[model samples]
Target: MDVVFSDVKGMKEEQEQQISLVAERNNVSKENKFHKDEQRKERMLELFLRTKESILEGWRQW
Candidate 1:
């Protein structure tokens, strides 16, 4: 669980950096690219959270 938590944290940080770079390149703060990137990141975070919950549930069942 610790390993997965670390991996998700790293991924979130990396994605944030990438989103900033994309926004810089596009020369827009509130553009479609930024919105889409944010949405994607949110989805990714959601998935990771769901996975963590599932893992915990499995452990509880065991």
Candidate 2:
């Protein structure tokens, strides 16, 4: 009976550790995804501003 209890306790600890690891991994994945989205938005905005500036400069020359 004691051996069975010990085995159960070990299994519970292992499962808890696995759960914590998965949660951490998920958090990191979310952060990475958010970072990538922000970078993409910044790049798109930069492109738009550059295009707008070029068009305005052309009009000014005319």
Candidate 3:
């Protein structure tokens, strides 16, 4: 009986640790995805601004 109880206790602790690790990994993945989305948006905006500037420069010569 004592050995059974000890085994149960150990299993509970291991499960808790695993849950914590999984939660941490999920948070990091979310952060990385968000960071990538922001970078893409910034790049798209920069490209749009550059295109506009080029068009305006051409207009100026007319």
Candidate 4:
């Protein structure tokens, strides 16, 4: 009986550790995704500004 109880305790601890690891991984993934999205937005904004400037310069020359 004691051996069985010890086995159960070990299994429970291992499961908890696995759950914690998964949670940490998920958080890291979310942060990475967010960072990528932010970078994409910044690039888009830069492109928009460059295009706008080009258009304005052409109009000024005309």
lDDT of 2 by residue, 7-38 (tens): 99999999999999999999999999999999
Pairs of residues at least 3 apart in sequence or in different chains that clash in candidate 2: none
lDDT, candidate 4, equals: 1.00
lDDT, candidate 3, residue 51? 100
Q: Could you tell me the lDDT of residue 57 within candidate 2?
A: 100
Off by over 4 Å in 4: none
TM-score of each: 0.52, 0.93, 0.89, 0.96
Candidate 3 RMSD to the correct structure: 1.0
Report clash pairs, candidate 1. none
Write down the TM-score for model 2. Answer: 0.93
> Which candidate number would show the highest TM-score if scored against the true structure?
4
By the TM-score metric, which is better: model 1 or model 4?
4
- Flag regions of model 1 displaced more than 4 Å: 1-30
Q: Tell me the deviation in Å of residue 26 in model 1.
A: 6.2
> TM-score for model 3?
0.89
Choose 2 or 3, whichever is better by TM-score: 2
